[model samples]
Target: MLNEEIPDVPYHVNGVEYERGYYLADGIYPTWASFVKGFSCAVDKKRSYFTRKQAGARKDIERTFGILQGRWHILQQPARGYEVNQMRRLMYTCIIIHNIIIEDIGYNLAENDWVVEPVVRMQRTWIDRCDTRKRRTKELRDSEVHEGLR
Candidate 1:
């Protein structure tokens, strides 16, 4: 899993070049240079701040999973389907139904009587490939970015 080579999506960050995305993982995962992990034991104010922020972000993901499981009880327990296709279909169906329900009721907001328009962003339609040297450079740049993020 650590060595998996995903397709590159080039993007600029603070004038630094990066070619791929990364995943947020816990300390148990290997330091593959692609996975960003929070400091296990923060000793200083800066480290503590980063750890707190990372924990909050992780908790948000956990809460989202909890909500999904609650809404679709099928996700609460291990999937009984033996085939990958069966599991995929089941999850896709649940997500479509969830979206329809959400669209019908709309998202509840703190301002009960007001509805805000959703923001629109540009969509990319093309993907480009990078050579070996470029990929290696990107991996190093990504590692620097990961450290800076921490």
Candidate 2:
């Protein structure tokens, strides 16, 4: 799944336009433009701070998965569903139930403060498909953005 490439969705950070979204990955993953990995050894204060923040964010995700697995034992064990769609629905249902439980218990931190934006679906035209050369160019641009982020 990690090896698969997804459609490009442009977004900006600090006035810089990134051609695609990225994932928070570990050192073991390849230094691809889409995977933001922390420094293995931090020599400067800036690097150290960034590394710490990245690790904390990763930990939060790990903790969330742990909680989900604990609450839904079916996720922890081998999926018993015969079809992939069935398994997907089961997981989705579990997540929705978890969110409902959190809301019911008044544990939602962004209940009133967070604004839900309607998702805008982009039209896929022939121009959106990138050839080998264009793909490499985009990859280079993405690599630059990744470095700037670091």
lDDT of 1 by residue, 1-150 (tens): 122333555667557766656667778765545676789889999788978887788887677557777876656657764477878787677666655666688864335543434434344333322344456655644555677545
Question: What overall lDDT goes with each candidate model?
Answer: 0.63, 0.70
User: Which ten contiguous residues of candidate 1 have the minimum total lDDT?
Assistant: 121-130
Q: For residues 65-111, what per-residue lDDT tens digits would candidate 2 score against the true structure? A: 67878876647767764488888787678667767877898898555
Taking all chains together, the TM-score of candidate 2 against the true structure is 0.62
Clashing pairs in 2: none
Candidate 2 regions with alpha-carbon error over 4 angstroms: 1-11, 77-98, 101-142
lDDT value, residue 147 of candidate 1: 71
